[model samples]
Target chain A: MAGHNESGKKKSSEAANDLQTFSAENLQNNMKVIYYSQTFLSIVGGVIAGILGFKGLAGFILYFLIMAISSVGLIAKAKFSVHSYFDCWNRIIFDGFFGGLMSFVLFWTFAYDIVHIF
Target chain B: MAEDLVLDTAIRDWVLIPLSVVMVLIGVLRYFVSKLMRSYQVPDAKIVKEGQVIVRARNLRSGANFIPPKAFRARRVYFSNEENGLLFVPKGQAQNAQAQMFSDPNMAMDMMKKNLSMIIPQTLTFAWVNFFFSGFVAAKIPFPLTQRFRSMLQNGIDLSTVDVSYVSSRSWYFLNLFGLRGLFSLILGEENAMDDTQRMMQMSGFGFDPTKSLSAEKDSLDIIQHEWALPKFEQRAEAVLRKLVS
Candidate 1:
């Protein structure tokens, strides 16, 4: 019974050490890094989709695939310790997913029309 | 898919390319214009101090568990004490801030400048697109859309038979207007004033009531039940070290 109580205390103590405090500057810098990378990746994806004559659902699926790859790259960049740099997993995985969508669509349509249609 | 329109390549050269190019140029131009027009108003010292006090109080509240109970109590009292606390703005002065904000001509001038920088180029761009590329079918999206999007995607072109994927020139301009936000952020940087949506949000959320925020912070600070976590952290650290040694 004492061993169980001791283990419970140890667990609570360990949990205390996991409390995180993030500075505004570091958080903002992390966000900027994500935004910049996502924007660049989305544009590239759009261009590739456009060049390959991707149409309809394929183009959007390609965008999401690119974003997924970007997320993986970000995870690798963070060395798989996303919690050290970000407050939540979503910050790295899904932060700029939709923000980059318009750029992807814009470039996709531009490239598609230029290459295939025109 | 309905029969695809074999659009003139001339429409591509004349309407589509120019409209996009013009929009990009105008976005860059607007960035620089807003940059030039942005008046660096030195924030009032009292406002700055109030902001700092609020931030410090918030930090103290959030980090209270890291500090000793006595220290947390002292800091909380320093901020939220009923008589002479930093956050205790008298009722008279709190009401005066609204009148003061309105009475300040420079604040109004700054607001006008911001509105002008945003409004002028936007109207000009819309007018230019409307006048030049009103009814022309510029380009087709690389994706299918539902019939619900026909009216939106085919604006200015009153064609009933055209595919919803086919974007009219003016509608394409609108697309570029909203879609170029990512490009602008890439080119101009994150906090640029080129985004119309952000500017509209800022315009609507114009008033920053400092007293209200300060009192709210004070109330929040008062309620923080600080249980010091450092003792637990130290025990955890010691246990980890012992495990490493074993």
Candidate 2:
């Protein structure tokens, strides 16, 4: 416990010099940006899926699969240094994923009906 | 299997395309409007001083272990000393500063502007969508939804024969409002005020509250029990050196 405490102090001291810590608000703001981009991609994905006439489960699956690819692109944008990203945003990636999934259905259905039925 | 009802091509040109375009334009306009409405206030001196005092105390606690024992002892004594210590100096200073910030007329005015900027565009767009595109079931969901969402998703349209999955045009506008955060970020960059979802959350008291945060910081600082880590540093360093020699 003492050794852990010392290391904790050392890390905090380093953080003290650095103005920005991993505060909740900062993390939320960063996650908001990530979520926004993901939602955009998901909407576009839904539209493309709709245009192709993929319906029901197939459409849902295809939309999420496209989102997973975007996640990979995001990780690659960070040069696969996921530890830093995870350190800053642990739960946010999942939140964005699920949130994107919900909206993907909405846009996917809209585009599909508009394109296929029209 | 249910028979698919064919929609006219003009539906896309008239409803879907126009609604999508309007949603994007409104988001862009809201971004610029909120930007114009932002209030950048000069930070108060006492707040800055209080922040500095806390940071200095934190630095003393964390970095003291790295310094020699004599230096560490001096800093510890200076900081944790009861009567004149930096940590406890003017205990309610942060509280008063935070209170003043909350009560500042400029802050209240800025908040009003922000709220107005968020509220006006939202109400206008909602009213416009409702006025123009009230009854059209703009889209049909591929998957099934519960009966509860029937009223929400298909707000203006109500048909017993129509499945609950069909969403009205106004709901589509609302959905686009929430879903277009990425487009806003793409066009205006991150941190734009085009995020209506986030703005609503803030207005509803879910987002950043500065005064509460200030008080929380003060509370955490109050309970901090500083422990000196320099007393056994030499022993640890000597052990590492011995290991290297061996």
Candidate 3:
């Protein structure tokens, strides 16, 4: 509780570094895997959504189901407390957004493509 | 006889030859274009930044041997990064070094073994890329970068520390919305020098203002980020919970 006590103004990373006393420059070397995996999944999601466009209701439900599941995952991540005091703040927040937007996307795809397909 | 011969030549040579050529061209072009546009590559010169956080020491064993003191409690949670997770320090780095040296190996091993299956953040991890990115990307338009961002939490190397990175703008907006500056102040016992960052971002709109120009904004998918201060999914989760709750 007494840690991270320092300056009153600076960049978030710099401010955090100042509190650490020791700098932790997290260097990630391989990021292609992460990006490709995401893009691939999006395309798959897009394709499935394209096929399911045949059924108006089915299309809606499919995206809704995925997004709903994701949002729940976000809530879980946020509420999950690894530490009592200061939690992994960004972790909780990103989980929430990723889950929320994907759910929205899945449903939106159906909504947008339904008229075209059916 | 001439008209019949002309018809035969049209089918065998003129029509079929061109048709086959066009089909092959279309097929080859599709494959090449897909490969080119499937995903953008990270430039070899592009640098990937990362970091880690050690956690604080909680209830440890008190016995003579390296083990949880007779009352060692199963730790409920761990630091996102164990090295940087030390929220409180009894002494300084010197004391921590001593503790680490004398700690029981078994206990450390026990801590290392995690149920990784539970933490697997696969496709569902960012479930709503379908919602925002679907629309934004479908239109091939950029949008405002308002969502919570996640950088490499663990660089997956060295195993010494788990790295975490996030956008500065999201952090500022989060704190401002939930009055979290106070929360940070409360826990840290003092404020770090992060006050000026948000003001700078806001002035520039943190590079997120679709209304300002014809240029596109970053939609929700820009960084695949979210914030609890912005609604941590509990409200949206009512529908999803039906399976378990029912």
Over B69-158, each residue of candidate 3 has an lDDT whose tens digit, in order, gives: 222222212221224322322234444443543463543332222112112221232232222222110110011122222221111122
Instruction: List, residue by residue over B67-155, the lDDT tens digit for candidate 2.
Output: 66677667656655667755544555556555665677875676678778878988998898889888987777777777888778888
**Which is the winner by TM-score between candidate 1 and candidate 3?**
1
Query: Can you write out model 1's per-residue Cα lDDT over A2-105, one digit (the tens) per residue?
Result: 01111111112333445645565666677777878888888889999999999989989898899998888878877676666766789877877887898899
Candidate number with greatest lDDT = 1
In model 1, the clashing pairs are none
Lowest lDDT sum, 10 consecutive residues, model 1 chain A, at A1-10
TM-score of each model, in listed order: 0.91, 0.71, 0.20
Q: What are the runs in model 2 whose C-alpha is more than 4 Å off?
A: A1-40, A71-81, A88-95, B55-81, B89-99, B193-246
Top DockQ hit = 1
Off by over 4 Å in 1: A1-14, B193-207, B239-246
Error of 2 at B76 (Å): 5.2
Which of the CAPRI classes, incorrect, acceptable, medium or high, describes model 3? incorrect
Ten residues in sequence with the least summed lDDT for candidate 3 chain B: B135-144
Which of 1 and 2 is the better model by TM-score?
1
Report the C-alpha lDDT of model 3 over A29-87, residue by residue, as the tens digit: 11111222232333344446654443445544654554444334434533443222122
Model 2 reaches what TM-score against the true structure?
Answer: 0.71
> What DockQ, on C-alphas, does every prediction get?
0.47, 0.28, 0.04
lDDT of 1: 0.80
> Fraction of the real A/B interface contacts present in each candidate?
0.65, 0.44, 0.00
TM-score of chain B of 1: 0.92
Worst 10 residues of 2 chain B by lDDT: B206-215
